[model samples]
Target chain A: MSRREAPLNRVVMALSLVATATWLALPLASVAPNRIVPGTAHTATDLLGWPLALLACLPLVALMALSRRLDRVRCHLALALVLLLLMALPGWLAIASQWLVDPELPQARLGIGAAWWLSLFWLSLMLIELRSRLALVGWRAALLPVVVATAWWLQGAWLGSLALGQELDGRRGDFLEAVVDHLLLVGGAVGASLVLGALIALAMRQSPRVERLGFAVLNFLQTIPSLALFGLLLAPLAWLAARFDWLSAIGVSGIGWAPAFLALLGYSLLPMVRNTHVALSEVDPGVLEAARGMGMGRGQVFRQVRLPLALPVVIEGVRITTVQAIGLTAVAALIGAGGLGSFIFQGLGQAAMDLVLLGALPILAMALVADALLGALARRLDHRRLASPGGAP
Target chain B: MSGRQVNAWAAPLLWLSLLLLLALGGDWLEPLLRWSEPDARRVLYPQADLLTLLVRHVQVVAIASGLAVVIGVGAAILVTRPGGRDFLPLVAQFASMGQTFPPVAVLALAVPVLGFGTWPIIVALLLYGLLPIVRNTLAGLEGVDPAVQEAARGMGMGGAQRLWQVELPLAAPVILAGIRTSVTVNIATAALGATVGASNLGAPIIAGIVNNNTAYILQGALMIGLLALVVDSVFARLLPARQ
Candidate 1:
């Protein structure tokens, strides 16, 4: 680390320390503020024991002392790190409470709400940082937040909160569990939809007739409303129950995950199929001809030439499918999928904002994580031909 | 194998076959293939003919998708102008905000002021569809060949004429493709219109869920899905093959 890096790292260290302390303190603070020692409770927990807060001010303080400290990257690093710490403050407070207070009491669970708020706070700050960086640097950085917030809010409004108001609540645990549930539902559904969609797209590629059928099927899937699709799946699913004992045994109960997952899967197919077909079709004509000239059959040409070249576009389709599926999965909650959407509906019923927030936060985080992780994968795949040392045959 | 004969015969024949299969053998297929169930609510609605539903949904989806295309394309275009590049990302940011905010939330937020039905659904659909439209339009227009544009200008066409006659026509296929995407997405999203009281196909779906009638649910779902497929295929047929 350079001279600037040192201060930046120190400030970051201080922030981390403060955040850790605060998160540990929140549950305890919620319960027995007095029992945890006077200074240790709030004073010691005041953002990494006061020194860190002062440390937070150090970069700005140093900027005044040294004219050269105004470098752009340095300023950005300082700002981003400090904001990251500030965002982490609530969790730190929650953690501190947990460490200092009694665990068995109901009040001690303030950590739950605190942790929730902190993560949200962190997300908000990251968003702001992302926006500012976009303003300062360029637009590509803006992609993550845009995709994330869209996925998040779409889920919050549609699934997690059912267009209900958001507020602070103790139901964060339930919301977290619901979020995990959504990930499982959305992850599985989208994963399968992508596979099925790719297969259909691939099948369409096999012949003009198949292509036309794929086109028709995909179109049909795209036109139907999500809520309607869920409804459609129910009857067929129920029919399966009538025909098969196992299906009846495992069929939707009052309302549950199956309807939601199936609906999401159906909704995702259009984009996945269309994008795959277009991508595969667009695989350089010359490349296909070259493969054929080399005596490679259709299957070999597709596998060796077309599919690999089309992977990036197919991935793009999957990216859209995944993001859209996350949003649709929230609607699945209407069918009793029991994800964050459950709270959204409950909040709508009760007219409470906090319940909505408890549910919405996790969905937002999931979108962010998914976008980040998958986006990284997509970018990596984009450069696949270059990564392989030898030139294409 | 002739291209003209293929196009002439294939389109109508396919539609006839699909319709005939769906209508005549539907009862038998119901028991055998068992694709979906009959909807009692659809019977109650009285105005369930394919044309009426199509026209109504087209109005809803068109207004929504139209607004999305204009705003999305406008923003995309505006940002590329001089002194506008910095704000290009901002446009994407805002559009993403529009998207992530959820159409339902937009509906909820709009309903207080916009007050139920068509307008609210339109606004929600517009916002929901903006991202794809704007992104694709920008990509399409920007993707145009500079040499063609330079030649257009070199031939004495002014910026406006160049854009209208040359650039736009060249970008038409891609931009229209984006429009097609927006339309399809809006068609599906318009289903949520039922929540705020905009009449579309969502009514039967919601009703099916409320009543625990699998047939009803399947009816609504299958119809919507089929509608989407038909519309998508139509759009695909309309699109000129990519150069």
Candidate 2:
């Protein structure tokens, strides 16, 4: 190693410092005798004893120390330390449950406290900072979460007394159903918008007037709040269902998935149409000229050249629409559309925070996963386009 | 400011007046709303008047978006400066990633930590709204021509002065666009706050859902939709001239 001292990495240093502070200062876990009663908060010192609690701070201190002279090896070591801290978090909760809960009391539950959450949050931020510093991307950046998740899975049995687990235990079937409902709603809306958006984009391409008017209408629809759009659709659909037996038989009513689907479709169209139009139009004119000079007709040029080049941006629009629809579908639960959001509103109605977590955590995970997957897909498509022999560099 | 500017304001003013008229004089629309729900005993949301609910709704969004602008823009500025440059990558990544988290999920998650109330809604909105502002501000600030910045330095402008006089002014249009997106999204999200006991415009929609009253839902939907339109129109007007 060089004798010269490296500059301090203040970002990681600050993050570790906050993590250490919160770990020691705030409650790490809470113990409740039953689900109905509020829990008694426990700080790290009380829960793990002074020696063990202080021992837990060792990695954080090491992280801060390492930041003063960050090198390639030190950065890698710091990332490993961060991941170790994250994985151990669930194990800590498992230990808390074992020590605090009475096995005889089946109703007993252990709640995660502020410190645990803050520590987890700060550690994740540190991981991000380190990952970018190390220039890790794609699957390399995903390793921490995979490891942490595996650790949590290994500790899952011990966390039977955990509040979130208990909530899921009681409503496992409903949870599965809600996940399905949420996916179906999001998938249906995104799929429909892709087709409709393409046709609209194609139509707009034929005339300047259509382009202006189409965008104007979609923009107006996009401006309306999801809740209001859902509300407005209810009365009209109900009236239509009342007048048409087929519509009623087919599950088209005032509420439920009909209004929800319609509203999601409305929200999804703006991004879809805009992206499609831009993607289809923004192809290089030189490329089109080359295709035409190669004796290709208009139809062949469009299908073989323009469409392939446009696929990545169109996929990007799908990504945005899918993520947006996932959230709006949750709001659709308010109008009797069954999804994970039912758990949220029901939990809020009952003042059951764990149940809210049960609902929220999964939705959060879904959004993140969808975003990651679709983003990867788009990047891969763009890469393929650039790499193709005939494609633009 | 100018005749063209005044002319540009016409659409927003029209929408604003229409929103206010509906909020203040919703009772006059009862005869029309009654047709939607002929069997219901009460056709309007009776718990609170529409105008008051409208005010409260706007207040919640205003407070949330205001704080988001300050903190979001401030953090963006900080990370772009020499002292804070080390933090820029993390801040930028977080801002983009954070937007992927659904607004409803954020609100739901907040309820667990912050408990139920208007404040949780505000906090959620603030947190959710911060992303666009930070993202846009970073883009705006970074988008400034380095040559222009170099010239400013050549003219002996200090770091702070160059930022204030050169960078921010050049970035104002983009920053304003971010604020517009944040405020518009927050207005919609705040309506969902009613389900969490916030009692804003969304309260009527929640109530209407509970009672199976179409009239009440329509009223709430109309007012919230109109509110969104009015605000969006104002942003639309503001955006064109500067761009």
Candidate 3:
């Protein structure tokens, strides 16, 4: 390692630090009389008069400025500590918000400002950059969640500070319903898409012409903006529902979950079909010839030799489709499909950032979780394939 | 063009010509659609011409996707370099973050700060489009055969020479695939702009939804879907010919 490696995202870290400091020093949050009334803005010092906001940084800045010259493990550890501290800052802000609230103003609504968001963005940026260097493994990765949870737990002792929490608390039932609605929309679309997509793949495998047509159509369908696809489905769906009383009874209207489900299903088919096609076609010809030589009929060979080899890739397709569907389902809110997007659109309508976050955060979490879990599974399957003796069949 | 080339170009060409004709002759075509339903709303967004809307839509997509390609490809190159390798997962996560957030959410968040405009739409589209380009570029560049790279190195090529002459050319197809997916995806996503008050193909769809008129929606869907198909087909044409 003769070459000097550049520090990863140090520039981003510096900018983040600057932004966070500005967030703390400036009016950290705005306090409204209620959700409707805009209130006064106060920095932590102005509000709490104790600079508890700055206390979040003690873990970050405790190390001497000269610590940059320290050994690799030490410097890395310091950076990791900084990350852990930054994660706890939001919770500290929540605590400070509660601590600062006067008893007289019980209805005081705390709304997060741009500074708070910018600070969070930068902190995450710094964390992402620093995490790669930490070589976090085993219990190491668990440390972040534990610290972040601990911070939240400590802050929750006074519920007054958490604005977003209050927003959720006000409509806890609605929030949960929205969450369930989101899952249903995503679940319905993904389930329908998987079965339909597999059928399409199977049909495509019957002939080259089928494959070409299927791919081109699916690919083209994919290009149709989700909004447009929903639009296209609306007329036909409405007509079908109108023509058939049974369909209308089954909730097959032009809008809402029906069009949304159909549109999501349309968008999902390309990846699902493509993965399945690729997985199935990529099965070794030699293995197939051997299977046939071993007196395995077409059906038996397909069932025994082909399915196992293709299952992981098919699952990969499901993963991709599920993750994509999770995000796309948010758009279903536009047509009154009632998912997390309802909150997002409602937030937009009311210019409420918290409501938008309420919707957007969960979708983001769902996508990340799906991506990580599916990705790990895919990697595991690939590892098994690689580790097995000889080669892929 | 040769017979094979003409055959290759046929579908995209027809689609392209039809799109141009529709964009120019949308006013005339509105009457034809009305042949089936003369009473329904034929001209959904009477305020804006479909051509103007299509042009703006193209402009938004081209700009956003063009920028996405530059930033995505550049970031991919940077991270793949030995010095910047540590940042690869960060870049990947960031790009995927854009895709995972859902464009509507991004738009909803962006509108307050950015205000309503093509810029917010562009921001959403750009972020949404980044993943495929970055992901593909990384995969493509990494997929270059090490043996081929060694041979190039053995041939007395400098790092720059080897990369420009050998690696990039080899990776071009895969990178192109990523760009294709990104651009095509953005073409669809850019329609979200109508919600934020950017005049585009989505104007009619939003109008249709509001008015409960399917004709307007059909008109917009047709145009956008046609646009997506043509662009995707063009991308498919651009791929290096397989053996």
Alpha carbon lDDT of each predicted model: 0.60, 0.89, 0.76
> What is the overall TM-score of model 3 with all chains considered together?
0.85
Of candidates 2 and 1, the better by lDDT: 2
If ranked by lDDT, best first, what sequence of candidates would result?
2, 3, 1
Off-target runs (Cα >4 Å) in candidate 2 are A1-6, B1-6, B46-48
lDDT score at residue B30, model 1, on the 0-100 scale:
46
TM-score of each: 0.63, 0.95, 0.85
**Candidate 3 ranges beyond 4 A from true positions:** A1-28, A36-55, A61-83, A99-103, A122-154, A287-304, A384-393, B1-14, B35-38, B143-170, B233-243
How many backbone overlaps does candidate 2 show? Answer: 0
Q: What class would a CAPRI assessor give candidate 1's docking?
A: incorrect
Judge candidate 2 at residue A289 and give its lDDT: 93
Candidate order, DockQ descending: 2, 3, 1
The TM-score between candidate 1 and the true structure equals 0.63
In order, what DockQ does each candidate have? 0.22, 0.70, 0.49
Model 1 residue A261 lDDT score: 75
Which window of 10 residues has the lowest lDDT sum in candidate 1 chain A? A157-166
Kindly list the per-residue Cα lDDT of model 1 for residues B20-77, writing each as its tens digit: 3432333344443332335433322223333354456668877887778878888887
TM-score of 2: 0.95
**All candidates in order of TM-score, best leading:** 2, 3, 1
